[model samples]
Target: MSSQETEVLVVGAGQAGVAMSQHLTERGIPHLVLERDRIAERWRTGRWDSLVANGPAWHDRFPGLEFDDVEPNAFAPKERVADYFEAYAKKYNAPIRTGVEVTSVRRKDGESGFRVETSDGTVNARYVVAATGPFQKPVIPAVVPDTQGLAQIHSSAYHNPQQLPDGAVLVVGAGSSGVQIAEELQRSGRQVFLSVGPHDRPPRQYRGKDFCWWLGVLGKWEMAAPPKGAEHVTIAVSGANGGHTVDFRALAAAGITLVGRTNSFNNGTMHFASDLGRNIAAGDANYLSVLDEADLYIARNGLDFPEEPEARVLGDNPACVTKPLLELDLGAAGVTSIVWATGFAVDYSWLQVDDAIDAEGRPRHQRGVSTEPGIYFLGLPWQSRRGSSFIWGVWHDAGYVADQITIQRGYAAHVADVPLRQAATSAQSHTELSERIAVTQGA
Candidate 1:
């Protein structure tokens, strides 16, 4: 119905888009951020009712907007976190248009910019950022369509255990969502049979510190790549809350049936591969490896952090006997619901540009910088490094991505010459920090 033009257009006003806008606004960059829903819509609607940030509020703060006035150690719930984003969008009065869904993003042939077709209007921008989300569409197995007579609900739509039919529930997937939801369901007195998969079962508290603290201090957050061969092991923290270890052992001990990975559901029967023992063992090994890495980092960095009692291991759980399940007769089990905790899928079907997408169907980019002249992506897991998808991680990427847009437009460098990661990684940065600390102590 109407038209608009801007130097840059950012899609999705979530953590990534808001962070990007924060930097762009500081530089006097002309940009418009469009959100199909409210800011942090995913957090508001997609997560469970009791969902809290898996990490501490202190570590999850966006740059310049640290967790002030909020409990630093408390794991902020979904509403609190969503409100934080809303407050952020309002604090700076970010140039965000909510409820504006972009239907298509295509290169403007003969023109250098892109044409963004939105529910409100069309926008022409020199730079287009695909910051929609890392968690977009929920990916359910194809065989799930054969789940006749069973109430099928993906974790995205699952708010509480009461919402499902009162009977045994099968949580399909062993990632954070699946584990957390299954825990909740079982706690709600529902028999939750968890379909196990390759998962990272790191301890929530390691050496008397939150796992995140170890990750932060050890610079483990900087290493942002999916676990080798387990790309499904997202760079997610271990717990549903910022406290306690959550593993198959823990879940299994809590009276939940731990089954093998789901193969398919056909003819009223759900089939599984007998990799339960193997997966559990592998997860346990990876967990130890992770702790060892953190331990190594602490020792090598000469940190004098105190250690607590030894953390518990899944091996000790007697209920964690991983016998493979080949088939689950949904009718026989009287399973009234199947919660698909099978993570989300990214869709770039709207990104209408050739050579812009990589062979893996991901935006061809290195550290948020796209292969295309003016196209960029933000909020991607591992966009810059391991922490890219996390709240703190977005700030670093937003600065870099915004600077790339502004600098190309011949705007004065409003962004810092040295990026956050570089500053953290550079020897000069360490020297500067040491000097500052020394001077402060001297003063």
Candidate 2:
């Protein structure tokens, strides 16, 4: 096997990975980004055909590059997002090795770095950044029994309404994915049965502004955790068509059947928990909590904004909160397809360093810093803040990792951001950015 060495090693070529590579490159860090597939592989293969980014195009962009000539508020579809990464990588000439999947990450023998084993060969680096964002593996519940014949697919595999078998679809998990897919199927004239669960149902827009705007104004993006003893609730608002909430109430209003959480499937009957109304109410309540935070922020700032109508709090025609359907006969309901949008599971099984993971096998890190030096993580949900896993947020954490990697590599400064002076005369002052970066990397 071939052996190579670099200053830093980045695994995965998604949004976070690419961003991390760019930042490290700028700082003159010698790094190699190993991607399991093409750039933005998950965006290319794991999302639906009609799936648009949950946020606007402008908000999804990386640090240096804005969507040139593209509408800022436009909803970027999967391919658009993928192409942006490809362009960004090429623009920066990122040191990426596509189709090279990393198999193991272990401490180098008698060294203070990591040895990365990939399909092609091995690499040694002073620092390692695991930038594989969230949505690593689709998590289908164990209770979802093996369907006898119904075609079942995870939300990641779902492409469009036409891809499913021509029959009513049962979409388990009422999160953004579940709600979006159900809405798509419903619009395609297919009956959709959505399973309700605990979720946040923040309005797409509030006070004539995008919901995220309020979050930013309230400094919620920098929030890494909730108050002690308070539950950490994941926000599930959808941003289709600029900003639209795809909650249970929205689905019910769209004629999608709202069912309770699936408990078990036995003898052709799938039992459900009787918590539909409670779940919807919980979502509304969580949304209210967010609004409350925003409200406090507004009062603290003393900003006067018009309030939206009470009915518009959820939707134009919010679905009346209904009782849970405790049981559903799959055959009788004509549910021919089941799409589990239960979200993804985080896994770091390839990490071989002791103490790298906690008892739960999750990365044992604080703000991306691992217990083991030189090993860091990026793109984890709430890794640093509530927005850590989001496109708008991953770049922040990536920049931090880049600085750490640079410092760890014994660069000229804490980071490779030092200006590279070309031995110019004393009269020459204020070196240009291009020259500085060029000479810095060359050094």
Off by over 4 Å in 1: 234-242, 297-304, 312-322, 358-361, 411-443
Question: What's the C-alpha lDDT at position 134 in model 1?
Answer: 77
Stretches of model 2 off by over 4 angstroms after superposition: 226-232, 292-307, 310-320, 410-443
lDDT of each: 0.77, 0.77
TM-score, per-candidate, Cα-based: 0.87, 0.87
Local lDDT at 419 for model 1: 49
Per-residue C-alpha lDDT of model 1 across residues 65-168, encoded as one tens digit per residue:
76666588778888888999888888888999888999998889885789989898899987899888678878777776642877887889999987998899
Please give the TM-score that candidate 2 achieves against the real structure.
0.87
Assess candidate 2 and give its lDDT.
0.77
